[model samples]
Target: MTKPIRKAILPVAGLGTRFLPATKAVPKEMLTIVDRPIIQYVVDEARAAGIEHIVFVTGRNKQVIEDHFDVAYELEDTLKARNKTAALDLLEKHRPIPGSTSFTRQQAPLGLGHAIWCARDIIGDEPFAILLPDVIIKSQVSCLKQMVDLYNGTGGNVLAVEEVPDDQTQNYGIVELAEKINENAAHISNMVEKPAPGTAPSNLMITGRYILQPQIFDLLSKQDTGAGGEIQLTDSMLKLMETQPFSSIKFEGRSFDCGSKAGFLSANIAFGLDDPKLASEILPFMREMLDQPEAAE
Candidate 1:
């Protein structure tokens, strides 16, 4: 039987260079999409998938991310004194149980593989999930939950993949399918990180969610710098794939690549539209803006 996945590793060590000046002091993961931080959405997705522990592989100046999860005593006290029951209830509902979350520092700006490797001890001897906070997928079912459901049946490395245009394959880590497993999944024959445009094996690009076995840690430890002079996770996964089965799940969701400025703005608008309260205020304004771009500006 497949061991139940209980822990998840979130590699949050990257410098959000794409977001630039805004991320100078604040960690990009702390940036808000609509009403909550990007990290919160990612964590919520993990929690929805039945993950028991959250191991955050963080870097410098990312303490805020840690604090966000911890109890805010003064704030809680103030709310309590003010008799803000609803707000207090919301905070209590969102807070993770004590000892369920752990954080480790990645002292260097290594790479995604190294970042996940840093949390090896915390994730000892078990299958763990990795969710890139940069990508937020919105759907009736969370993306990680879908991957977890797939892992339960397949019992191997599972990745969330999405179909992309052939010409756009060069922009992502494209996968070559050995065969179709089902309507929702395919056997991943090989993975190529950002292949040259026309040479892409297939147009299915890896979306940032992963369910990997503990054996990946050993491969990442000796992984050499690949595409960017840093140990790439895809490179290590490729090696692990030689011995282990890797499959892809075409998750039912709309993903927002929050790492880019355009994607970030799009997420804010999309999420804002999802909120009933906000939609009533945002929709007509957006329609007007579309109808008269200059006047709205």
Candidate 2:
């Protein structure tokens, strides 16, 4: 039987330069979309998918993320004293299963592959999931959960993918589709890292969510820098692909690249409309704003 995917590695060490001044002190993952911090949503997605342990690859100024997950005793006590049981209950709901989350440091801004490899010791020998906190993919069912369900049955290596425009394919790692696994999945014969214009095999681009075997660590270790001279995860994954199976789980959902200011603002609005309590008010406000003369420009 395939081992259940119980552990997840979250790479949160990136210096979010796009949001500079705000991120100079605060880690980008701590930025809130509506009420919850960004990483919190990633954690929630993992938990919803039955992930038992969360391994965080962190860096300097990322301490706030650690503190965010730790028990806030004083704050909890204050809420208790003020008779804020519901508020406390909400916090309690989101806390990781006790003793299930661990943190390790990636000392430098090397690359995504290196960040993932930093948690090698913690991940041990099991297959694991990697969640990119900044790429929040929204669906009625969380994207990670969808991938996890598929992983349980497929059992090799699974990546969450979505279609991108032909012109936009150059911005992402495009995969060559060989065969269809199902309506929402396909066998990956090859993957090209940001292929040149008109050379992409298919428009199906690899998005963030990934479930990979522990063997990827070895591949990542020997990976040479690619693209931006950083150890690109795509390079290692391709090497790993020679021996193992790789499939892309097509995710048809709204995805927000929170690494940019515009993307962050878009997520706020998208998620705001998705929220039941806020949607009724937010939708009308958005309609009114869009109808304005200034918005036409």
Most TM-score-accurate candidate: 1
In the range 1-297, model 2's lDDT, one tens digit per residue, is: 778899999999999999989999999999999998999988988888888999999999899999999899999999999999999999999887679999999998889999998999999999999999989877778888888888778889999998888999999989998889899988899999989999999998888899999999998878578878899999999999999999998876878899989999999988887788899988888899999999999
**CA displacement after TM-score superposition, residue 125 of candidate 2 (Å):** 0.9
Q: Considering summed lDDT, which 10 consecutive residues are worst modelled in model 1?
A: 288-297
Question: Number of the top candidate by lDDT?
Answer: 1
lDDT tens string, model 1, 227-280?
Answer: 778889999999999999999999998899999999999999998988899999
TM-score for each predicted model, relative to the true structure: 0.97, 0.96
User: In terms of TM-score, how similar is model 1 to the real structure?
Assistant: 0.97
lDDT of 1 at 28: 96
- Worst ten-residue run, lDDT, model 2? 220-229
Candidate 1, residue 72: how far the Cα is off, in Å: 0.3
